[model samples]
Target: MIVLKAEVFNDGRHTGENIAAKLETMLSSWGIPKENVLCIVRDGGTKMKKGISLLIIKNIDCLSHQIQEKFENEEDPLLWWKVNSNKYGILSPVAKEYLVTPPTSVLSERVFSGAKIFYIPHRNRLHGERASKLLFLKFNIPSLQFNY
Candidate 1:
């Protein structure tokens, strides 16, 4: 999962237009075509729904959220779709994609927490480039392997 942005919102209200503009800006900055954006998974907030509707892309509800609402344990909705994929035929692939979406922004929040740690009092004087390099290595180095 690529994190496009991680900044605090200073706006008084989060309107649909504002959300759409932000999304557009992010997509444009990354040179990602809007057509490549499959679906948006967001909480069922009025503004979020409105913003998604403005994007002209499909919107899916978070699977973990549905499980939380109706089940005591974490249920794998993708497993259910896998079992029923043969029954659904062509639509199965699409269902599987939607099922894998994260139900919340907890992962991103964790990254922000890590950033806060790196930006502590004494180290706060670190330049933006240095801070960014530190964060990049902090988050990404573990994923690399030296097989030699």
Candidate 2:
């Protein structure tokens, strides 16, 4: 659920190559080595798939993605993966990690929703830097106060 980037883009078209380049730049800026990025979890959109593929990282399907097709048992995929982790030998840990993939982009959506609360019509004149700082504090203050 970590949010590495929350930028507003005005690009007319978002192509796979452009997305991949941006992702690479973002990862490098964060000091996250390419090898450390094990997998990317995204929807089945062609653009998303192509972008992730260009990154040279494994791309996995969003477990809880909604589609017209339905499975017989509607069990939680993470739970199922955990229960069967033992069955996978050398890849067991990878399996568990994959299971941790967020079923949806709800966390990012929530952050956007929270940001909207701060940027009300009356307060829309706030400077971009001020707004960013306020949003950062609003989201991270709780973690900062932890005893650990």
Candidate 3:
């Protein structure tokens, strides 16, 4: 899994159009061309669905939201997609893109802890893109394996 980038989103209005615009801007900034994006994996909120038309991308319902009660199957999605990507043609890359995204299971307290670690009261310049990368690395590195 990869975090790619983790920039702050301090938009005043959280409308679907605004969200889509920010997403496009972020994607462009990250050097990800629009053609590479198959669809966006987001919750089934009305606003999220609304962004589909504006974002010019299909919306893939987040699996966490899809299987809310419990995950009975123990299959890894990345492995499954990797093995079957060729079978679906264009969909293969699309599914793989979504599967590589790091999952969000952090609790509220841990998030506050990350905030504390990144931004102390006196040294409050740690925000925007720099802080985003640090926080992403801190949370995701533990899940990665080393082969040394």
Ranking by TM-score: 1, 2, 3
Q: TM-scores of the models, in the given order? A: 0.45, 0.44, 0.40
The residue-by-residue lDDT of candidate 1 on 21-139, one tens digit each, is 77777778889887777544646677866776797656655544443433325767677667766654446798787667578999778778778978888886889888778888878
Error of 3 at 37 (Å): 1.4
Highest lDDT among the candidates is held by which one?
Answer: 2
Candidate 2 lDDT over 1-148, as tens digits, reads: 5888754446856788877777788888899987777554556777767777898866556545633333357787666656655553335577677658688999778889888978889996899888889888888888879654
Q: Among all windows of ten consecutive residues in candidate 2, which has the lowest summed lDDT? A: 63-72
- Model 3's TM-score against the true structure: 0.40
RMSD of each: 15.1, 15.0, 15.6
TM-score quality measure for candidate 1: 0.45
lDDT agreement of model 3 with the native: 0.68
| Per-model lDDT | 0.70, 0.71, 0.68
> How many backbone clashes are present in model 3?
0
